[model samples]
Target: MICVGKLLGVKRRLQDMTDALSDMEAGNGNRRILAVGNEPTADLSYKMNEIVTRYEEQLSGLRAADETNRRLMTSLSHDVRTPLTTLIGYLDAAHRGVVTGKEREEYLEIARHKAHDLKDYIDVLFDWFKLNSSEFALSIERAELAELTRNNLKDWIPIFEENHLDYEIEIPERPLFAKADPDGYARILNNLVQNVIAHSRATRIKIKMKQKEKEIEICVEDNGIGIEKADLPHIFERLYKCDKGRSDQGSGLGLSIVRQMVEKMDGRITVRSEPNRVTSFTICFPVKN
Candidate 1:
């Protein structure tokens, strides 16, 4: 009878020890309860934390995007209204005979100029939207880099002359070739040149192209007012403008467009600047294999 009692006591103690271990694993040792039994896969706290984190991140992104959309709508409205008002004013003056003969012709010309500027802005905004939305399809074919550069430069001759700027074109006699969409290349150069003419108070601008190993360097150097170091990092940021506000505040969209075009081509743009010493935009792109 004593032996049987001792065996029974030992078995009871073993079962108690197992129960304590199970409670400890459940993190209920201090106030032991088995509401959530400890078999593997008992805890859901980590997954809950991850889900909460992802939800917060998505919500923040949505809010930021909404704010940007609102700002863009406002900027667009203002830009459109200003030019439209000028157009209406010019026509109203002509209709009232306030402007006649030579004056009327001049006013019409001014209105026409405004129209052109507005058209360009609208076109850019359209393209920017398309590109941002991933709807810009690049039909990549074999492109001659030097030829494209030459053609684009030729088109800008009148602009260079109008700005009283001199260009020092540096391109190799042998054409450098790349795989790109012609329209995309045009946007890149156009944006770069416009940026110089509009922003750089420099009298002389130079466009240089050089073969750097497997990559090519196309540099637009200006001797203008030059950009401040503090503004360089944000130079390519969309809608960011410096406070200097030259009489020529420009469209304020040039450099940002340049960066976009370059990235679309899988290329990169780098810049170096000082207050007035020199500023250069170097776009390095890979050549076709």
Candidate 2:
């Protein structure tokens, strides 16, 4: 009689466990093994519960990732299409002779600017794609950090002047050598500077660099409409946009690309901002021995 009773208890526990597992496999992630106290199969129940918990966590993460990708596609459509449509409108007006004389010249210039804007947006999209892909390659080498930065910023001087932006640059006389990809570094600088130009309504900008212990520090500062506190934390996140009143000009990929390039070169980027006062982005790289 005791032997029969023991077998019946064992059978009941097995049946319960089998039903729980079936429920879990049928997409009921909330289903859990209910281990009967002191039962022979309690240990198996605990192990099964652990496995199900992990499975649920993985499924949740995958769902979140899929949602993010869906949002990105929506943003891509709006960002790429808006400027493209405007560019087409301007070109059509120009080609159809909708204006003449100096008016025509102004229309042509506006069309040209819009065309450049479209190209820049497309370039940012391509850069984002490349950075996220496995095949993206970097050519890292030891280079004179100060010299490379100076060469890159020189081109921006005229642009700053054209925009009537006051600027100051400070670089140490001593050679600052760092291991980095020159092209990537240049892109980083360009994106930061362009951010100030295109978004920050600032009259003065500063670029400063120096050696800090074993690291080389480069700072890009602007006395512009700085980022709000809420947006600062997310500026580097892919596709994140500030809610502040600054113009939403780019494809929202510039800062994201900047961060990826910095990390690929074994460096990091940080930003600090005081609204309408000062906004600074600092890049730190390990100095090459």
Model 2 pairs in collision = none
Local lDDT at 10 for model 1: 56
Give the range of the ten consecutive residues with the poorest summed lDDT in model 1: 33-42
User: TM-scores of the models, in the given order?
Assistant: 0.78, 0.87
Highest lDDT model number: 2
Cα lDDT tens digits, model 2, 225-275, are 899998988999877778893566666779999999999999999999999
lDDT for 208 in candidate 1 is 93
Question: Which residue ranges in model 1 land beyond 4 Å of their true spot?
Answer: 1-43, 245-252
List, residue by residue over 1-289, the lDDT tens digit for candidate 1.
Answer: 5587667855665565467556555654242222233422224333433554565577678888787677767778888888889898998898899989999999988888888778877876776687678566776667788879998999998889987998889889998877677888888888778777767777888999887777878998988888777878888876667765222344455677778778878888999987777888999888885
Error of 2 at 97 (Å): 1.5
The CA lDDT of each predicted structure is 0.75, 0.89
